[model samples]
Each structure stands twice: as structure tokens, then as C-alpha cells.
Target: MQGHRPSQKQLYDHFAPKMLGVCYRYARTLQEAEDFLQEAFITVFRKLDQYRNEGPLGKWIYRIVINTCINGIRARCRFSDTAGRIDVEHLENESTAHPAAHSEIIELVRQLPTVYMTVFNLHAVEGYPHEDIAKMLDTNVNTVRSQYSRARTLLMKKLGSGPKTNENGKRG
Candidate 1:
């Protein structure tokens, strides 16, 4: 895929759909997910020579996609939060987007605040550990854990399945 348009297009075609799903898990809208997909592919092509060929190409491409998502979050979040922090601002203009049909749960995930959604997708959907998430986000482990906790709580509450705890935080 290096310096070859047809090969690049072929690779993109083969991976774009699944990679877009990966992007969507971390993006708020379809447009944002598409943008991330394009960006990742661009990076993939640029770094094709660095692939050591020790692993499956799809896994390598997936790593690029994940890195692209995290980098996108970092780039957009820097202005909202301090350096070395992953806390991000809510999308003020998100209400204008008319998303195409997708899963109810996916839409609910997208409804979360950017930081919570990112942490949640990285840890839960991607099967990454909290420690890895903290490293990826350049944040403390406890912060990632709390963010994951908050994300789960929010999702459960939205799903009407939050822990059935009483006033004292015990099971009802």
C-alpha cells in the first residue's frame, strides 16, 4: 500500500467498514467517525514501511485505527483540558447532526460526554485494561477507573438497569 494508489484503495476498501465501526465507538457522530477512518488510513499508508510483518496485517491496521482515534481525541481535547489530561468538552453543536440508522445502544454510548465515552469504549468495548487506558489517555489509573465507573453508571441508568441499590447504596 505504499506509494501505490490501487493497493492503497484496495486496503482501504477491505478495512474501512470495520475500521469505521471502531472509529464510531469513540466518535459522537457518523461524520466524526468517517473523518477518523480517513485519517487512520492516511496514517496507515504513511507508515506501511514500518510494519514489521511479525503480526497479522489486520491487527496492525487496527492498532493504527485505535491510535488515530486516541490522537483525534487528544487533539480536540487539548484546548478543553490541561496537557496530560483526557477530560474533554461536550460537543456544543452535536444536536444538529442527523445520524443515520444504527444500534440503540451505540446511540446511547454516543450520548455520553466525550471523555466518558472515550474511556468507556477503550476499556469496555475494546477490552483494554484501565491501566492501559490511563497510559493511552496520559491520565492517572484512578482517573481512568473512575471515568469507566461513571460511564458504566451512566449507560446503566440510561438503559434502566442501574444497580438496584437503596438509599444506603445497598441492594434494594
Candidate 2:
């Protein structure tokens, strides 16, 4: 069972950027994302031997990244009450230069409550099913659905419906 081990360097080279993207989505800053990614990588390495290979390695790494992001959020919230709640009013109509961080839509998503953020990211961004999210977050399936509904409502208010076509199916 212990005859062969996955190459650590190969693992890093394969998953680092994608995992970092997961970390960055839930983090407020690049430094925070880097820290989260580092911590997540440690966990991945520790649990590497437990990986059963039933699914893709990227999926396994994604779960680790998500858990790490949640842990980082919890740790920050422990020290400061302001960790989860940030005012986005002042950030409205801001320039949308940066693709991920500075994007108004992404900023709005980041402003959502932690539970909502997690649910939203898993559902909308990561394409996880409500049942899976319920299992992962230890909540009821209905709760996951409700959270996604609420998240979508909030997102619509912030990001607007996508561009509308004309009644005849031509450009508006």
C-alpha cells in the first residue's frame, strides 16, 4: 500500500494555480490567498496518502482549498468582528480594471455573508449540486437551495441581469 507515493513537485505544478484561484475567491487580499494556499497545500500533502483515486486529483485538491478558505475565514473572524461584514456601499460603481479582485461583481460576491458566500461559490462558481453542498456544509438540502436563492437575489441586485436581446431576437 505504501510502495508508491505521488510526486510532490508534480502535485504542486499541477494544482497550485487552480487551487490558488479557489483561495483567492474567498480571500480579501493576495497575501491572504497565498497564506491560505500554503496552508491548504500542507493539508493536501498530509492527506495525500488517504486519497483513494476514485475521482480526479483536482477535485480532491479543490475540497482542500475550500476547507482551507473556510478555516481562514473562521480564524480571522475569531480575532475581529469586522472580518465577515464589510461595507460595499463605498465600493459601488468603482472601476472594473482588475479581472478578479477589482471587479465590482466579484467584490459584491465577496461582500456576501460567509455562509452565503460558501454556498454561492460552491453552487455558482464551483458547480456543486445543492445536495453535495448540504453534505459539505453540514446543512439540510433545503437550506442549501435557500441560500443559493438568496445569493442569486443579492447578485442580481448588484450585477444586474445580463444584457437583454430584442423581442425579435436581434440586438437591443
lDDT winner: 1
> How many clashes in each structure?
0, 0
| Poorest 10 consecutive residues by lDDT, candidate 2 | 78-87
lDDT of 2 by residue, 47-112 (tens): 878999999988888888998887787777531112111223322333334345356667788777
lDDT of each: 0.77, 0.71
lDDT of 1 by residue, 73-151 (tens): 8887741221111111221122234233226566777887788888878876788998998888888888887777777
Q: Residue 10 lDDT in model 2?
A: 70
By TM-score, how accurate is candidate 2? 0.65
Q: Candidate 2 has which clashing residue pairs, if any?
A: none
Candidate 2: give its CA RMSD in angstroms.
9.5
**Location of the lowest summed lDDT over 10 successive residues in candidate 1:** 83-92
Clashing pairs in 1: none
